[model samples]
Target: MTSTGEGPSATGSSSISANTSQISLADQFARSTEEEIQFALDEIRNENDKLEKETGILTKYLKRVDPKDIQTQIKGLEASPVQQDVVRVHKRRSRSRTGSTERLLKLTTEQKCDIAQREHDELREEINKFKHETEKILDTYRATREEAEIRLAEMKKSSYEFNRDIVLGAKNLRTGRVVAERVTRYFEDKMRSRKALIEKLRLKNSTLKVQKKKLQLQLKQKEEMGEVLHEVDFKQLRIENNQYLEKIDERNQELLKLKHSSGNTLQVLNTYKKKLNNLTMESNRLKLEISQRNELLTKIDKETELVEKEREKAESINANLRRQLQDYIVPEVLDYVQVRADLYELTKTMKTWERKVDIAQMELQKYQKQWLMMREHNRTVNPWATMEQHAAL
Candidate 1:
């Protein structure tokens, strides 16, 4: 019996081929993924740089549009009550509002970065999803390849057995033909499925390429818009310069008005000076009166001191008399005097209490009379109650 075992060289060659194909596939996937990621990063960085440059340019342009001097002039002009120029104030307010609106419309670097970052995150998530999907597909393909390898091994064994059987005249030619047909049909279906999968991958790749192109175009358009914005900034600056010149002129007119008013102010100052001189004369007279009043107050204070001393002497005499009355008087006499005083106070308090009691009694009698009248009215209104009261009596 002849052995149909595969040679070592043939097995090694097949394994080598399989390893090389797998390495090529892995390398292609890695290169493609890296290129896409690098491309996206480069695009994002370029956009960021452009946005920074534009933001800086805009900020500088806005700074140049109106200087501090112009704003100060406008503020001073607005505050000039002498000129109450409503038109100028309104114009300034409107300009300020417009400038604020323009500033609001201009995106800051941080804001631009936030939008870019959001887009980047979304794109990154999409890339991650695509990578996950690709990995899943690759895993499925790997599993399918393993299954096919196993099936091939089974087929090889079956084919060897079939060939051996044929050589021994055990298997018929019709059976071999049926086995060959089944193998051909299985390979044809596998090829068709693989071709469809490849076509789908190609379609997806083409769509991604188109999307990338669209993104590139959008970036270009954004750069062009930045240029247009710069131009608009220049135009706006020019307009603002003109407005500033107009404001300077208005300020000069206000200065002229102020100069004219300064003359009137000088005349008013002279009148104020004259009044101040009169007030000084009046103040000197008042100062003299104040001095006279101060002298009179000193004299009154001296008299008050003499009166206070006399009052002190009188208080001392009274205090001495009170001490004599307390110490020299007999205890019985003192007690009689104290009792008499207490009796008098008690009688006064009793008289007040009696008056209160009399007023209270009179109020009570009035209330009683009102109650009697109310009861009589009730009895007259309700004759049945009156009859019941009489029956109870």
Candidate 2:
């Protein structure tokens, strides 16, 4: 009877120790989580402050990076001499009507370059800022994850110890009520703390998700801006190229006029070469006719007439060839012009197709997202109906 009474006391003491340990563990876990939450919040505030500082710096940098101002200074320095020369050239080519085009092309190119450079610098700054912000967020996520895991492990250990105490206490009816009460209190406290931590985590996760979406939107906008800038640059290059092509065409026309005037020398040279060849053929024919005339001198008059007619025909063919050659441009030059035209058309078509494809893909993605949302909504709202349909299937 003494051992049995002592047994109850011993079991009660052991149960009390277990309850104390469980409560201590829960308190420690709660404290650690609170500290961790506070630390995470502090880190977030610090990061926000860093971001603000970075933004301010970027703003200051932008104020210094005005490409237009630099371009204006450069233009001021370069314009004095160039303007005089351009005016002289303009007067000389006043009748050509090309001076205005040249001026417009130069102005547009300079403006486009300034715009592209400014945008590029801004993009570089933004990308660096985003990268820094992302690194900070990653660090915060890692720290929070590690702390959550540690807290979860502590909770599990405490619950296990509490459950063991309850199982041991159940063997003794006298202490069972006290152990059960303590365990009940422990569980209530645990549940309350767990709920609080979970809510905090949920809120944190929601905020992080919102921040993630905002960052993604910012990144997308930056990419779109970059593409737009690139297109502007490309358009500027195209305009300059067109201007160059116009100048080349004008030079080609001038060369053609010069060739028409000077080409007579070459044409005469070619005519002489042709006539020499015709003379060689005529000499051979004359030799054969002479040989035949030696055999039959009475038919010499008929042969002479026949040879004269052939010479006339040869002369007519030579005249036709000369006219054709005079009218023909160099084949190589013509081929180049035709190829350039084809390439331009091809580029235009390709751009149109690419734009259409991008639009179609965007539309398809939108439709797909809508379909997924509808499916999710239907499943959530009419789960029983979905289950019945599946069962029928």
Candidate 3:
């Protein structure tokens, strides 16, 4: 129970410390920008300082490692004779424990420090290189952003002026709407100067046009009063009249073509009228045929009904006669012969009725085919009335 309680307490304390450290780191990140480049530089400097102190310690420890002892050991090993591998190993182990262990420990610690220092120097170089690259990127981005902002401002100003001037329009126009914004003094003066020049040019143009007309009138008056027109003027008139004459010729040709087309259109209309009349006559004939066929079918149905009644009567009479013959022996041969004749006649009549029924079925099928043909014709000729006619049927 105590262990569990202590575990929770320890964990809670560690979590609180971690939270505090994280909050501090977040504060550092939030405050420092250039994407925390200065913070990274500070970290790099701290790491480099640590590496320098370690390098200094290593230098001091390296001084304690005697080069003379290492040289003497190397010479001794070289001078030794060839020996068995087990004996050599035993000797080497003994020497390591008694003589070289301390020196080896010092050398290993120095090597570790050197490696650490070299790694730190490389990391520092890479950090500086990355810092320069990031600074270059950020600097270029800021410069470009500032330039773009200036251009945007200029464009916005120009756009405002364009919209204002266009929407304001000219006061001389019919709309009575007023300009929403006042012009600057420079623009106002510039507009006034341009308007004055425009007015002067407009008056000059009007006067020049009037003078030209006056000169033309005088020339015409001179020509009409006393002088003949120049050959150049006659040539100009001839040219203008020739253009109108060509257009008139073209229009006359078009009129002839239109008249021919109208005649063809009339011919086509007459042909269609004659065809429609023929179709109307044929449709009337078909309708008459359909009515006649319907009357014939009605008559056939009535004949069939009469035949059925006659068959029923004959059958009843024959049944009664047979019953009588069977119950009482016939005294007359003539009566039996009459009964047989009556039975033969009934069979014959039944065969006739059956043949009539077969004929009626064939007629019905033929009528259905004719009706279908008529329906198809109606669909082709009088499409709007087909459904109504079919429903009536």
Candidate 4:
């Protein structure tokens, strides 16, 4: 009886240890699955972050490199070489506008215009294509991340039921637990405890079967992806890359052309710029001279007005003098009492003296004749005696 009881006890203990090992294995598997799910979530999050950073960098670089200047340069390159005049800005204002073109070019302006138009159309198409590619990349990233998040949510909800519903805890413990709890009611509750323990084991067994079915369903839900990116998307990217390579070749060819022409064109452009500077300086000098002339004209006008006023004053004085002289009849007075009257009086007095002198000349002639005759008669008589008597008297 003792050996038989020991054999049954040994068998029971071996079965209990096997059950414990199975439970431990299941627990280990559940923990490992949870860790894998968390690792997958972490990987998805990291990928999403990397994609976000790349998208942000792409947008920033796109924004930083403005294409307007490139477009402008392309337009200028395609423009007619004959059309030289261009709008010039000075001091924040337009100083000169493009002039009318003349003399038909070697390759007509119309042809160059066509080339420019074609280039513009091509550029516009390229920009739109780039925009579509960017949008497609963004959509792909968003779809993949959104799908991953949805799957992660479902996985998390399903895992929440694991702690409660999975066959994860110490499951075959009823025999020992009963013996320990019913120690006070040992002899009286033996049959009841055994029946209760059997009922608990049966219930746990049913639960384990249901959990197994649910776990199989979860396994079926695990998706198998054949590719990360679609073949079509890859092919489109390849086509774009080829197009970019072609563009690079074209740009290199254009750079070679520019280098070939740069020497002469640069010298000519410098000459033209120097001439333009000289012309601008000359124009400025002319404007300054014109301003000075206008100022001088103003000064001349002022002086003319002053001269006119002075002339009017002189004329007024002359008119007043003439008016004062108009009422007077006095002639200019002579210094010697009408000097002609004095000459007339002297003439009258001279005539009267001439008459008296004529009469006295006749009497003197008669006396002289008589004296001559007497002197002839008494030449020897008394001339000496008369002279001596006159001397004594």
Cα-based TM-score, every candidate: 0.20, 0.21, 0.25, 0.22
Q: On residues 208-235, what C-alpha lDDT tens digit does candidate 3 reach at each position?
A: 9999999999988997897767789899
User: Candidate 1, after superposition: displacement of residue 309 in Å?
Assistant: 99
Give the range where candidate 4 is weakest over 10 consecutive residues by summed lDDT.
84-93
| 261: Cα error in model 4, Å | 3.9
Candidate 1, superposed: residue stretches over 4 Å from native: 1-104, 169-393
TM-score, candidate number 2: 0.21
Write the candidate numbers in order of decreasing TM-score: 3, 4, 2, 1
Per-model clash counts, in order, read: 0, 0, 0, 0
Best by TM-score: 3
Clashing pairs in 3: none
Model 4 misses residue 79 by how many Å?
Answer: 72
**lDDT of all predictions:** 0.72, 0.72, 0.71, 0.66
| Model 2 weakest lDDT span, ten residues long | 98-107
Error in Å for residue 381 of model 3: 97
Candidate 4 structure quality by residue, lDDT tens digits, 1-393: 000112345556667787999898678667787778688679889988965654443333335434555447647786333222111101112211222211111224453454345556766888999999999999999999999999899778656643333323323365423333333344346468669989999999999999999987666565343334577979999999999999999999999899879977999999999999999999999999999999999999999999999999999998998998897677667845687788999999999999999999999999999999997787668788778877999
* lDDT head-to-head 3 vs 4, winner: 3
Give candidate 2 regions above 4 Å deviation. Answer: 1-103, 107-118, 167-393
Candidate 1 residue-wise lDDT, 1-393, digit = tens: 001122456556666787999998678667787778678679889988986765554443334334455457667775332112322332343445432122112344464455445456766888999999999999999999999999999789867765564444343476644454555655577679779989999999999999999999988998978744576789999999999999999999999999999999999999999999999999999999999999999999999999999999999999999998888945588899999999999999999999999999999999999999999899889999889989999
User: Which of 2 and 3 is the better model by lDDT?
Assistant: 2
lDDT by residue (tens digit), candidate 2, 154-198: 989987877676656434575535555766777798799899999
Error in Å for residue 5 of model 2:
99
